[model samples]
Target: MSLRIRNLQSFLRPINRRFPQAVWSSRVVTSIRYNSSTPNNNSSRRPNSGEEGSNKKDTKDSDLPATNDEHNELLEKYNPDKSSRVGTPKGAIPAIDHDLASLLKKPKYEYNPENNTNEVTYEFPPPKSPKQLKVEKIREKSKPKSRFKKIAPSLIAAGLASWGIFTYSYLTSKTDPDKDGETGLLRPDKFLPYVISFKHQIDDDHYLIELTRKNRHKKLINNETLFNGKTMWSIEIKQPDINIVRNYTPLPLYVAGTDPVTKEPHLRLVSESEEQGKFIIIVKKYKQGEFSRWITGLNLLHPVEVRGPIVEHKFPGHPLDKFYIKRPQLANLLSKIKPDPEYPEKLPKPENYVYYGAGTGILPLLQLIYSPNPPKGFIEAYLSIHSESNLLDQFKTLNYFAEKIGRVKFHYFIGEKGEHLSSKDILKPTLPNFTGLSDIKLSEEQYREKLLAEKREEVKRQIANGGISNEGKKSITHEEEENHTIPKLDVSKFKPDNAFQQFNIFKKRKTTPDPSFAFVCGPEGYMADVSGKSDLNNLEMVDNGPIGGKLKEKGWTLQNIKRLQ
Candidate 1:
């Protein structure tokens, strides 16, 4: 163990001879240092700081196990790489201990980018706290929980609040708490309850049905805006079973006939009191008409939904206002109808009228004529019937008019007899034909002026009769301005004497009358001779096109003629 060979001599000897001499030394240096162009990759780019990086650096400087040094000599040296550092005083160099324990220290090579001139530089890591490693390990173990899981409860609460708002809005919309009052026999927004009180089966294809309000005793909206005879109005019957609605024209007539009567009474028009909460309809089911078939198959006392008083066609003016009151005025006079007492010419005489109808197209007109207060004109209705049996089957319908209606003359064109309505038949050779428009214009002006004169006459009569009181003078002014004369609803409201009421049912009018209007309505080709080629395919009630048919050639303008559907 005491055999000591010099260090320089051992390095110069052969490999086999040096091994024997190295075995006698206390420590072995397993590496030899040398310089090369390529940087030594054995060093890490930058060791992770702490005890681990320093340990790695210590072992790297020498390829030997950690050991004590043989010499106590220490040297102060200037690292050349740190000379490129900025802001150092001129010729000022910092000293570093180049001892064996300081071999772990390494300078970081860097280049100064801020300086315009390119230069090499070095940065030494600052000394860290000895307990920095303990702080980092604790941070790794104590990380915060995921933020999404924390917000889950808030998301669910917001979703529930939105759902509650939507549910409230939907329920309120259905209830419609703020709706105003409705004014009709039927409501547009919701269907009112009704019971089928009467159903008459005319044939396999035709039906006469009546619908009465559930609360039958109460009167409907007490107004005549639609039921007035001046315009043709209709309503729709809904079939909830099929989810469909069909438009129907309701007649004022109800079946007064009983099954057991020896002489079945003809269908009769309803009195004003009876018309309040009841209506009748004529339904003719076609081959594939689903809505019609459903209605025709209903039973008496079955419930149905109805809506409207849809205005179909409005005539020119209230020409009959002077002669008519509310409908059913003739119901009391059915037993005995007589002519009006003839007097010298009245101020405003009624006009003459002509009408052409094909099949069911005549229903609207029938409503106008049967209603008690018809226009102050007489109508010559020319109807087209499919066959002779059609008339026999419609006996009750014909009887209603023949027995009660006045001022209407019917002329039939039987299809089975091979007869069709033509323009020539509408205006015969001997009939008054005023070709020039002056006659029609003069008639219209005369009609308007005569209306005013008639109103003044009515006012004079009321005054002359000594029926007005000082308090009633204000009401007289309003009555004179209004065009129509409405009947009194309550018996106490009548100003007429007791004797007049007892004999009031005896009132009548002249059978022979005036005519002015010419109306045409039917199938497209059925009345082509009188009206134009119309497109009835569209169900909407639109304005008819320019009057371009045989009636136009016969000197009829819109002033005197109309083509109705």
Candidate 2:
């Protein structure tokens, strides 16, 4: 009986436990909610009900937080040094532990939120002590210095190399040549030819020294035979005053303007020297020419080598440049003055005209007037001036011009100032045939009367105004314009009929038929004589000795004379 009762008890207990389980299962079904609806405790506990299964799993996972290795790792990473835990926003996670953030805090900096973005950021830190800051700054600066240090050795090496190259070039340039050192190019190691020198009175007003170089082959040294007639020598001038040196030393004289008829070489630049290894040089010793004095006083043998023959003018055409013209008259005149294909052209009909010359200043102007292509509407004219009587007598060329172009009216003043000629006497109508002469003689009585009368009239006028006191007499004399009609005092006397008989005198004058140019040389006086009186037009100044008078209106060029070993 006891065994049967025990069996019933066991059976009942099993049945009871099964009944609770069944009840719990039933309750879960009735209270269950779908995943699409709000979660509730009455959800089905069965695995088939997705909502209940997921909820149960979540609850279980929440309860086993200690067992989650991932949570432990997260907590380990978030643990900061000494800060409190901070609450995070819902659905957001904290990136760092509060303790770690405390370590980054500094004085003068507070975390503040940016108004626009609502983002928190740290403010600028406080400035450190000056000494500590300076130390840090120095370290920062040293970084750049370290970088440059690497290249310092290389820079030093490069500098040394460049210095070595310069030293080598300087040394090489000073060495002597192998041959003909006497006549070779001037160099440090070679000696220039020594020339004998002596001084002589050139005139009452001046003294100059003549130089003669050591024996050398003239043909080899002077390649151009232009100086066959004149001497190939140099002169050293000596004057005391520096002012005289400045006035007399014509260091550089250049040419300007084009040859009216021939568009030949047009410009020249010249320099003069009285030293060794040089060609002809013209040095003018004006009474007040300062540079002349300086040049003349130089010890010619004291290694005083001069440089010159610089060409100021060049051919208009070139590969690298377009010629630019400056003077308008020259441009216009040059365009019209084309070269004539024929050897000679018939002379134009003679027209009466008068000319005035002022000392030697009228030279270049005269050349232009006598030029074949003289400015349009030019007429035969008279010339007058004090005679250009000198030892050299370069003015003789004027006679040739007067002979060829029909005699120009001439009034000569020789020795002291003499008779003043009237324009009517010089500008008289002339025939096509005319002649020119260099010297003319008039009776002294007539010349003296004219001079005395002119002087008396001047004194009479001064006394009429109010007699000059002794002091006033020493001062400059002023003349009334009306009283001094002086009529541009005729420098030349004209015998138009006499000139007409001497026409066609230039039939034998040699001319440079080819494209040629001309240059004028000598003192200001000499230059003026040729410039104004010569047949060449557009007379330009040249730096060196002349090549030919035929190409007188062509360009003056600067040429260099080189001494080769």
Candidate 3:
């Protein structure tokens, strides 16, 4: 058996060489010895059993202990425990032991067999230090806050409040329709205070008052100069705990003369009683007008608040150009026509004007007539008064001054005391330039026959023109129908009578046709009658209130007729 064991050792020598660093222990060698000592059970299969036993013996021998030196060498070569050494190859990732990782993840438990209980325990991470906690807080605080989150609410609230305030103010504000929606609040800074320096009673109801402003306040009126009959100032008075305002065109208190230093003509304010800083206003008292009554009762040095040089009419250069050219449809038509050489490009000064005034209405007309360097025009004025004494002397004085600059003709309709002359009778014959009642009567009969003949000719022309067969002709006829359809005033209502006849006579008398502007300021009825019947086809009309409505109805454009009031 010893020999057999030696042979088996020899045969395993080659196998051991293949695994030179295989680990071995004393228990493994003992197991190999026991396996070699065991007997085979099979007798008939002796050879097969012997061979199998031998292979088992060899395998057991391979695990047997070698010499001490060889064992120590094997321990060094292939270590089972390498706790103190780096287990990874150089520049290579270390292999992870999943078993160790699972052991660490499992909870450790202490078994108490006596009580049949298990006490579970786990290790927790260490608590943070104060310094580490502070650092973490700082990192959190360093993050930027959202701007929308901080300010969005405040912005939304302010926007809503602003919109509400604007909406309320717009709804409550007072506006003027005639002034293209201008607010009623005039600039308070422009108001000037004056004192009534003098007052003279010209008649029972007519008074001439003089106002004076301090020399320091002269700058207030510096830019207050305006074109005659185009602008006026408002006088506001406070008395009897009531406010009254009236508008008046200030008269020239002084003659305009050339400035010696600048060579520019300067208007020197005239003071009738040698008073400095004086201006005059001719006011006619009315029975029911609070402002007029207050003015009549005003004592010397009474305080008055004045505002504006409010412009009623703005003079657009070249009247016909502005008047006709502003209408786009009309302008397009006019563009097709060749420009006329005789048509004046501009009238440096007006050529002709007709003025009609009664009582207080004459003040504006008088201002225009007496203006220094007045516009070059044939001015015809018709003045109607309660009595000859009321404005006869004033008229004479006006005529004397007016003749110096231009031709002026004045017709006075003076009535007996308590006998009020009808405005129609006063304005009718004068506007037509009839010298007496006989001329007016004769012209009326001829004017009726002439109007009838013109109507018949107009109908005949319409029929001859094929009525409305042509499309272009149809359009023209439609427009003509529209124009002719305008409501005409009753002949009795206007009493046109001889007005057109007088207009023809005036036109024939003039050497050449001149551009004209007509001004009528009197009773509403009188202005309506004169404006409706007057045949100054080339003239423009200006008045106050709706007195020009009749003219507007008779195909006169609102642009050609301005209502100041």
Backbone N/Cα/C clashes per model:
11, 54, 2
Of the candidates shown, which would achieve the greatest TM-score relative to the real structure?
1
Ten-residue region with minimum lDDT total, candidate 1: 70-79
lDDT (10s digit) by residue, model 3, range 1-565: 5455445445444434444432232223333444445455542344576588886677576555445754554455444555423232223222335874565467758864445446343365457899999999999899887999679899999999999987875665545222112222223335455668667676788877766653424333334332232332333334435754567756655324444784422334332223233456778888997778877898988877665555545533333333332211101121221221122322222346556666666666666644433433456667667776566354465465443222456666766645433443222111222234465456567777878889999878877766655554643557667767657555433322232222232222344223244565665555565453233334354332333433444334333443323
Candidate 2, residue 225: Cα displacement in angstroms equals 6.1
Query: Sorted on lDDT, highest at the top, how do the candidates line up?
Result: 1, 3, 2
Number of the top lDDT candidate: 1
Reference-based lDDT, residue 321, model 2: 18
Shift in Å, residue 562, candidate 1 = 3.5
Best of the two (1, 3) by lDDT: 1
> Which sections of candidate 3 miss by over 4 Å?
1-190, 216-240, 254-277, 319-349, 392-395, 417-515, 528-559, 562-565
Q: Report residue 358 deviation for candidate 3 (angstroms).
A: 1.2
The estimated TM-scores of all candidates read 0.48, 0.23, 0.38
Q: Compared with the true structure, what per-residue lDDT tens digits does model 2 show for residues 383-438? A: 34444432112223433444333333344444346643342332222232212211
In order, the Cα lDDT scores of the candidates are 0.57, 0.34, 0.49
Mark the regions of model 2 whose C-alpha exceeds 4 Å error after superposition.
1-202, 206-222, 225-289, 294-304, 310-391, 394-415, 418-565
Instruction: List residue ranges in candidate 1 displaced over 4 A.
Output: 1-183, 187-192, 219-226, 241-243, 261-266, 316-328, 332-346, 388-406, 428-515, 527-529, 534-542
